[model samples]
Target: MSVVDAWRPETAAGGFTRDDEDVAFYTRINALIHSDMVVVDLGAGRGSRYDEGSAPFRKSFFNLQGRVKQLIGVDVDPAVLEHPYLDEALVTEPGARLPLADQSVDMIISEWVLEHVEHPQEFGAEVQRVLKPGGWFCAITPNKWGYVGIANRIIPEKVKNALMRRVWPDRPDMDVFPTYYRLNTLARTRRMFGDGAWEHCSYSANGTPKYHGNRSFGFALVGLFQTFVPSLMRTNLFVFIRRTA
Candidate 1:
């Protein structure tokens, strides 16, 4: 068996095997989904989960098509137009306003997208403006204070692309983008959204050192070491907030 298959379960909670960051992220958003809600997928690309060749069981949680009234996809990349799950796909420019009317969407979900946001204030303004009153915006992103974020910020984009190609060959080069950690940290993000307009909650999560070249024994060893890292500097941040204004 591959390293992920053999070692992931050992690191998972209660050795369930299937539990991981993706499961946690999708589960949190899935619970918030309702049949009548219009959901916007911010920075949605061409249905990347499907491209990753995940099993049906794994992909099931990531799929968010018919469960909502409408699943609108907005992305700076035109590849979003090909998103299989989107009811409507609109192309947008970086730092440009979203095409939807103000308060039109009931929920917005961004996965691995915030790290690429160069203009956070403009992005936050669009998120707040597009969501209906009391709308929810949930996102999963790399924590700027974490090892991954630190390395990402320090490394050149070309080097990152090459390293990612070596470590995760399955992921396409087109999916990679330059990262700016301006909105990645807990303090900065909280400040950007502010307290009066949004009710927020955020937490950090850590998983196996998958970037360590797919070796099972090495992965297990590093995974154990990862447990001792402070919670605040964990690999990823899951943010959930409701628009209060």
Candidate 2:
């Protein structure tokens, strides 16, 4: 089954609510938006979750009616390409060679996807190959050093794999897909881009401590920690990189 067919939007799994936190977070990374740029959103999950009413996932696309030259949304799951804002959509395997032409795209954005990709180095290389000189790439993934990573390490591999299957039983076929942060560290990310291929702007996100049913106190506390020791927080990792010619 396709990834989309496996994971249906569970409103109970924290519905898509863009509060002050989301606005500020997205704004920082999307500040490089331009009208003439060919923007590509990778791993663009079911666009419905965020495109409610008219609010675009990237705040910069909010007022870009005629301004946007083209917007392409690509994902392994074909069901996620039904966004009104998308000029085109492509279904492709994750971590494999993207179907886009080399250096054809001006900007790329990905959210919560890198962690699930088994070969992130290849993925990063593909992003570098597809982006034009000076193009920007923004991505978000879970951090491996944060509290969640700690928890994952403590759990046995067998148990963790079982839990993942339970949480996403719909896609039992993809149960082998690596979950959680894998190749996501400041040093590792820099290396993936090669020597002087790109520059990092900022990397920050909230973390998760304990996952006790729906209680989010631990998650909230980790967010507070991000305010201070930003590097230590574990929930997510947001990165902005500009391609260098």
Candidate 3:
């Protein structure tokens, strides 16, 4: 058995555990989805999850291609044009206005995208502009106060990029972007998406440890520690906000 299999037996048969973070994050978004709603995927890449070999079951939950009326993906990377789960794709410049019209979308979802947002005000403004009055904006990002975020902030860029390449060999170099962490913490996220214009809830969550160096012992140790870490110290933040205006 592989180290991950030995460490997480529940994921031995497939890449899912009791409280899988992907499952949890997607579940919330899926519940908000309806057949006729127009949806936008912010910072959507070229469907890298498929390239990374996500399990079929997990992929089913992540794919929103046919479930919604329109699935538009917007990202800075041109690779987004080839995104498998989007009906349409747009490549935009940083801080540029989205091509979408005001109040045109019913929902917007962002996964692993907020950390790279250097200007949260511009980001939030764009999101608010495109979404309908009752539209939902949901995202899952690494928590700025978490261990991974702290390490990322302290580590040298070259060293961190080198280490990430070694740890996630399957991930493409282009897919890795520099993180600013300006909108990562709960406080900042709340401020960006709050102010009576939106009804929002943000919380922390823990996922499987990925930096165990392929060692079963290390994986198990970190997994145990992850379970006991305080809420604010959890690795990920899930933000769900609905426009109330």
| Number of the top-ranking candidate, with TM-score as the measure | 3
Best-fitting candidate, measured by lDDT? Answer: 3
Clashes of each: 0, 1, 0
Query: lDDT of all the models against the reference?
Result: 0.83, 0.64, 0.87
- Give the runs in model 2 whose Cα sits over 4 Å from its true position: 1-21, 51-67, 153-177, 207-212, 216-230
Instruction: List model 2 lDDT by residue over 1-245, tens digit each.
Output: 32221222332234323222344445764577767888887876556434444333343433333555787888888775665557888889866789899999998887667777777778888998999999988876667776566656578888876775554443435224456565666666777875777878756566322242223443355446655764665466677789988
Q: Report residue 237 deviation for candidate 2 (angstroms).
A: 1.9
Question: Which window of ten consecutive residues has the lowest lDDT sum in model 1?
Answer: 10-19
Ranking by lDDT: 3, 1, 2
RMSD, each candidate, Å? 2.5, 7.2, 1.6
User: How do the residues 116-166 of candidate 1 rate in per-residue lDDT, one tens digit apiece?
Assistant: 999898989989998888999999899898878988888887798888776
Q: After superposition, how far is residue 104 of candidate 2 from its true place, in Å?
A: 0.8
Count of backbone collisions in candidate 1: 0
lDDT for 114 in candidate 3 is 93
* Per-residue C-alpha lDDT of model 3 across residues 1-245, encoded as one tens digit per residue: 76777766898556787667778999888888999999999999888886556888788888998999999999999999988778999999998999899999999999999999988899999999999999999999899988788878999988987887766565666777888999998889778877789987768889878777677776877788788888879999999989999
In candidate 1, which residue pairs get closer than 3 Å at backbone N, Cα or C atoms, i.e. clash? none
Query: Which is the better candidate, 1 or 3, if ranked by lDDT?
Result: 3
